[model samples]
Target: MKKLFILCVFLLAGCATQTPSKTPSACSEEQACTIGDQNTVETMQPLSFEEALSFFKEKKSGLLYFGFENCPWCQEALPILREEAKRQNVSIHSILTRDENNELLYTEEQKQEIIPYLQDYMSKNEEGELTLYVPLVVVVKDGKAIEGHVGTVDDHDAHARKMTEEEKQELQKKYEDMLAQLSS
Candidate 1:
């Protein structure tokens, strides 16, 4: 009985030390690729948020998508960004919600630093400038706001048409519109 009690104590202590499990993949192929749209998102070019911001600052405009891995909408939105990047011949970087295995090469420190920047720039509301959403997007250029999504997913009518051709076109238009808003 004493040995069993000691084992239970050891197990409990180990459980306390364990980190939470990592989030799951956000996208499946069904949501990412489809046919027949000008806005089709079939591929992705990745860069960290900081790199994207630097590129955007130099280019005079940029788009940012902030989502975690385990989020369903985030999974859907990521492919849309990739498709847009590929069709447009651009690069899109993904900032993982949590990277326990270093798959995206995001260190704990880097992840900590990037999340704040994204939350501040992308999720801020207009009236209060405070955000309460997880999957958010922001369009910025020349230190100005263009278009921002507090919680809109990529599959949203504003950004995509789902896995259809028309949907692709819509997504493309939204991307261009967002850019125009930022660059103007």
Candidate 2:
């Protein structure tokens, strides 16, 4: 009985360990609010999955951005994302949820198929207005996925890995270039 009790304590300790926080300590409440309105900006007509998929196939070598309208980081990354996509000449898809604004993005046929994924693959909040925030980028060619993820955790872990000044500069340049392409 004593041995079993000690074993239970060890198991409990293992379960008690906390997941490392992925948010930066410097991320302020103000920044959180404006996360939707970032320094970088890019404009593009939103596309349906079918339209986006066709574009991806035509690009031959393309990047697919998987995200939703409600996620703040997804909004923050959009402009920078545009620059990078322009440089690489890839197609981007701002993902949609059936329960949210995605109503128009997908056909009635697709809702059942995608509903499960939107809820499971992305970080979902039951309350508040919904928006998908995970930053997912897939590089694909010839209908085959060349690089990307099939995992549940897709958001950037800048707090844990940390973003360097050099990386930020490079990202800024790329973002500017993408905006130019979209305008062109």
Candidate 3:
């Protein structure tokens, strides 16, 4: 009886000491092929363009980030975005701008279909054609894109290099500012 009690206590102690499991991330592929790196990839929930459209159609309020692993800017900004999202306790939905082969995920026709929904988030080029850029974060509320930010800081133009401390701070502030609007 004493041995049984000691065994039970040991088992209980072991269970108590074990770390609680974290919620499974929404990551799909073996890694975040679209976003890159397990850590950054795990922070976002991957959604199809159709799925994303449905959210907008349904007027669901959430954060949507568009980028792919191949995008240098995305590689640099995603980690920071993940950190900011965690700090704000927000979930981010991501879509792959390109496939593994670096091919565009959406056809021009498909893009045309969704252009109206995301027109505010996109920019027009010199040719006056709507262009969608990667590393774009859009805050959608009630089916309207209330706020959108593209790339990192204005000063850190190049994606090949890393952002300096000041740039990172500025970017964090930008993210915080953008995310703050979500609650409002």
Best by TM-score: 3
Question: lDDT of all the models against the reference?
Answer: 0.50, 0.45, 0.78
What TM-score against the true fold does each predicted structure earn?
0.42, 0.38, 0.76
Give candidate 3's TM-score: 0.76
Instruction: Give stretches of model 2 more than 4 Å off.
Output: 1-45, 52-61, 88-133, 149-184
Worst 10 residues of 3 by lDDT: 33-42
Clashing pairs in 3: none
The residue-by-residue lDDT of candidate 3 on 97-173, one tens digit each, is 78768998788887887788788878888999998887899899998888888888786765457888988888888
Considering lDDT, which of the candidate structures 1 and 2 is the better prediction for this target?
A: 1
- Badly placed stretches (over 4 Å) of model 1 are 1-60, 100-129, 153-172, 180-184
Instruction: State the number of backbone clashes in model 1.
Output: 12
Worst 10 residues of 1 by lDDT: 27-36
Candidate 2 TM-score, true structure as reference: 0.38
Ranking by TM-score: 3, 1, 2
Candidate 1 residue-wise lDDT, 1-184, digit = tens: 9999999999999999976532224422123323224344432333454664464446545555555665555555555555555555443334343344324434445545444445554444587544435455566665444466544334454344334566546655666565455335
